[model samples]
Target: MTKDLYARHRSVLPDWLALYYEDPLEITHGEGRHVWDSAGNKYLDFFGGILTTMTAHALPEVTKAVSEQAGRIIHSSTLYLNRPMVELAERIAHVSGIPDARVFFTTSGTEANDTALLLATAHRRSNTILAMRNSYHGRSFSSVGITGNRGWSPTSLSPLQTLYVHGGVRTRGPYAHLDDRDFIDACVADLLDLLGHTRPPAALIAEPVQGVGGFTSPPDGLYAAFREVLHERGILWIADEVQTGWGRTGDHFWGWQAHGRSGPPDIVTFAKGIGNGMSVGGVIARAEIMNCLDANSISTFGGTQVTMAAGLANLNHLLEHDLQGNARRVGGLLIERLRAVAAQVPHVREVRGRGLMIGVELTRPGTDEAAPEVASAVLEEARAGGLLVGKGGGHSTSVLRIAPPMSLTVAEAEEGAAILERALRSI
Candidate 1:
């Protein structure tokens, strides 16, 4: 029956959809950081389901909240008030430390980002958006329009007014090997030039850490300086924290906080960890930016009750357990171990990133080209040794990204890194 179902679905699904299964493992259930295949084989989750399960799978509190809320209500219209929705928004605003943040929830990160992109344009009445090269924002037309990668858009480029690229180098910092001051100056100059060439920019969108762009970390004070430029030009700084936020980075509650900005972003997007594994996403914009909203901007089923319940429970779990601190301590240990492993393995080119959101880059001998195949081999070997990993790179599949749940223990991280080292050795 399962095989028949898969065959029927494959017949109708688009080729470009990129289904993961040639002979897919039918996953039936998950708990904590472990998932069980239909055959009962369990996999220790290191990738955290693409960094979405911050609290791990089937969290007790989160599940209870969902079950309880399901009995009372599942969804409601935006025209009416719901308790969970109100509470979740309030919690997010308080934790974010963004004064007077007005949130609009959506069912997925892409939709949340879609609203943010439109909000930026509406508030500034401008079309040009400054973005980073190799950044992955979302898959929607406008979100993909601002994103710098061809992979996100198989379709032709959208005719937006302006698109600028920055930061695609091997060295540390946003612009690769540039000091914070020089990188900030160059990026600011680029933004000014783009603004002068086109009309004023609607927004300057960026991730706190570039997730899909090989886990790029911006230069320190980069966002602050860029924010100043955008503020001067009456443009919004849209911090796309889809992958970097929700305490996955470890040190900060949100990715923007790690950047050391004096004021929060004019707009910020959150998903993934917002509701554990549920499809809940949202944009938190300042009251000033949200003032631009009109009748047409509202979503029909964005902030449903079920999503709010899940979000609230996830936030509670994060706070009660102090998962952010765990992320910091455990992730630090993991990074140090990964660096040590890199030193031992010639193929492991570099180990970088903050807290739990770490990456080990690989490259072949004599060539600057990334050895993504080597990275893939490492992944397979790690899986053989009982671990799962995610891959990323611009040149090759050079990056082995380690974005485990905040719930991952220090001992678990050590075990995972040890397995990784063993895998590299086997290769």
Candidate 2:
């Protein structure tokens, strides 16, 4: 049955939409941190549908909220005032850390980013954008143009002239060997030099942690350093928190807070996990920038009553239950155990990341060469052990990404780590 479905999927879906493992999975249902397949085999869910499921699966609060809202109405268009949408916006705006903030909802992270780009360009009156190297924003045409990773981007042609900046990844770069302070200095120097040769940029978009680039990140305060430079020139700083927002990183409620020495970013965009798989995303900025458009703008299906209802329940549950505290506690233990396992394996190049968003990079046994095949084999073995993980990286997809729901428990973390240890051992 799985084989038949895989064949049909290949025929019907776009080839670029990738799937994991030698034999793909068909998850029938989920509860807590585990899911089941058609064969009744249960497995640990570490990826959380690409970290979209912020809370546990089949969570009563979110499910109940979704069902109740569905019974009433789904879409009423943006023409009418939406109570749930207004409430959620109020909650997000208060917590966004932006002064006089405004909120605009979207259906996905891509659209949210598209909205950000639109606002930045219109406000600054420039088609030039500054983007970080090895970043993955989204799949929209405008988002793709700003992305610096060739592996994820499909075409070279773009609507905006993007200047790629350094310091997104702390390892594998020319300045990797430098200390944190020196690295920041070197990157800032490079940025100033780049600015000398380019047109004025509308904004600089970056992920607090490079999600698709193997969960790598620069040292703390790197962005703060950049913010100082950009602020001097009146350039805006936009933090793409699609994967790193809402306490997924553990130490902070928002990823931008890590670099808060200089204050918050100019604009913030988020999507994944906000609705716990309900397709809710949004952009937050000061009223001046958000309202800089000459004409009115609205999203028809962006903040439907149903999605907003789910979002409200999910956000309240996440905060009230203290999931971010759980992530900090459990994710710390998981990363330590995985590091111990990786130490015994020579091919496991590096174990990096904080909280639940960890990455284990694989390489040839004695060389620095990336071993994508070894990464693939480890993924299959891990699945065979009843554990599900994810893969991503800038060097040919050689990093294993481990991001469970923020509500992961200590016992579940230990269990998942044990299964992952066995999988890494086999490789």
Candidate 3:
């Protein structure tokens, strides 16, 4: 049955849409932290649908919210007063840390980012944008233009002039060997030099933790240092919190908080996990920037009742359960366990991340060269052992990304670690 479905998927779907595994398993249903494939095999889900399932699989609160909202009214355009939308927006604004903030809802992160770009360019009156070297924002035309990763970016033609900046990845760049303070100084100096060459950009946009760039991040306060320079030039700072928001990073409610010394970013964009799988993406900014557009705007499907209800319920559940604390406690133990296991593995290069967002980089045993083949073998072995994980990196996709739901238990973490250890040994 799985084979037949796979054949049909290949026939109908775009070839560029990649599928995992040599024989793609059809996941039919899920509960708690586990999912079952069509063949009746159950696997502990670590990737959490790319970290979209922020709480858990089939969470009752989210399920009930969606069901009740659908029964009442699923969608009414932004043309009307959406009570649930307004409520969610109010909550987001309160927690966003942006004063006098306003929220704009969209159906996906790509749209949210697109909206942010529109505001920044319109406010600054410049089409130039500064983005990090190893960043992956989204797949839209505007977002791809600012993306610096060649593997993910498919086109060069863009309305905006994008300048790639340094310091997103601290391990493999020109300034990799520098200590934390020196690295920050070097990156800021590079930014100053780059600013000298180009016209004033509207904003410098970056992911606090580069997600598709294999969970890489710069030293703490690196962005704060950059913020000083951009502030002097009146350039806005945009934090792409798609994967790092909603307390996923443990210590910070938002990834930008890691560099909070400089102050909050001028604009913040988020999606993934806020709705626990419902498509809820949005941007929060001071009223000045958010209301900068001259013409009226409305998202037809954005802020619909159904998605807003789900988002509100999910957010309530996350806060009520103190999932952030859970992530910190459980994720810390998981990383330590994985590090111990990796110590015995020849090709595991680094285990890095905060909270539940962890990455295990695979490299040649003694060299810095990426070992994508080894990563693939490990993934296959992991799947065979009933543990599901993800693969990503700028260097030939050689990093294993493990981001379970915030509700992950210590026992589940240990179980996943054991299976992963066996998979690494097999590789």
Candidate 4:
């Protein structure tokens, strides 16, 4: 049955749409932290559908909200007043930290980011944009234009004139050998040099933690320093928080808070977990930027009642239970455990990340060469051992990405870590 389905999927889906493992598993059902694939195999879900499942599988509050909203009204175009949408927007605006914030909903992170780009360009009257090297915004044409990772970015014909910046990855680059303070200074100097060569950009867009770039990040306050420069030139700072938002980073509610010395970003884009599996994405910006468009614009399905209901419920659950705190505690222990395990593995290059968004980079034993094959082997072995994880890196997917739900338990973390240890050993 699985083989037949696989054949059908390959025939129907685009070849570029990648799947996991030697044999991809079709997950049929889930509960809490576990999911069942076809043929009745159960695995502990670590990746959470690319970290979209924030709280848990089949969370009762979100389920109830969705079901109730669907029964009442699933969708209505932006022509009418949407109570759920308004409520969710109000909550988001309050938490966004931007003064006089305005929220615009979309269907995915790509759309949210595209909207942000539109606002920034229109408001600042420039198509030039600055993005960090190894950063990924989304997959849409506009979003892809700003992406700096070569593997994910397919073309150079972009609507925006994009300049790739430094300091997204601190492990391997021209300044990797420098200490944290020196590295920050070098990146700042490089930014100043880059700014001299180009027209003033509309915005400098970045992810607080580069998600698809193997969860890599610069030292704390790097962005704050960059913000100072950008602010001086009246350039907008946009934080792409698709994977790092909603307390997944543990210590902060938003990933941008790590660089809080510069205050809030001019714009913030978020998706992936806000609706707890419902398709909800949005951008938050101050009124001056958000209201820059002369003509009206709307997303037909953006703020549908059902998705808004789910978003509201999910946000309530996250805050009520303090899932962010849970992420910090459990994720802290999980990373420590994995670090211990990685120390014994020959190919493990580095272990890094905050809260549940951890990464284990693989390299050739005793060498700096990226070992993508070793990462793949570890992924397959971990699946066989009843664990599911993810892989991503600028160096051909050479890093193991471990992002469990924010509601992860300590025991579950221990279990996942043990399975990962065995998988690393097998590799």
Total colliding residue pairs, candidate 4: 0
Give the TM-score (vs. native) of candidate 1: 0.93
Which whole-number lDDT from 0 to 100 does residue 26 have in model 1?
57
Model 2 residue 281 CA deviation in Å: 0.7
Instruction: State the lDDT at 316 in candidate 1.
Output: 89
Q: Clash pairs of candidate 2?
A: none
Deviating ranges (above 4 Å) for candidate 1: 1-9, 19-23, 168-175
Per-model TM-score on C-alpha atoms: 0.93, 0.99, 0.99, 0.99
- Candidate 2: global Cα-lDDT? 0.92
TM-score of 2: 0.99
lDDT of 4 by residue, 153-211 (tens): 88888999999999999999999999999999999999999999999999999999999
Candidate 3 residues 14-59, lDDT tens each?
A: 9989888999988989999999999899999999899999999999
Q: After superposition, how far is residue 159 of candidate 1 from its true place, in Å?
A: 5.1
Candidate 2 residue-wise lDDT, 314-371, digit = tens: 9999999999998899999999999999999999989998888999999999877999
Q: Where does candidate 3 stray beyond 4 Å? A: none
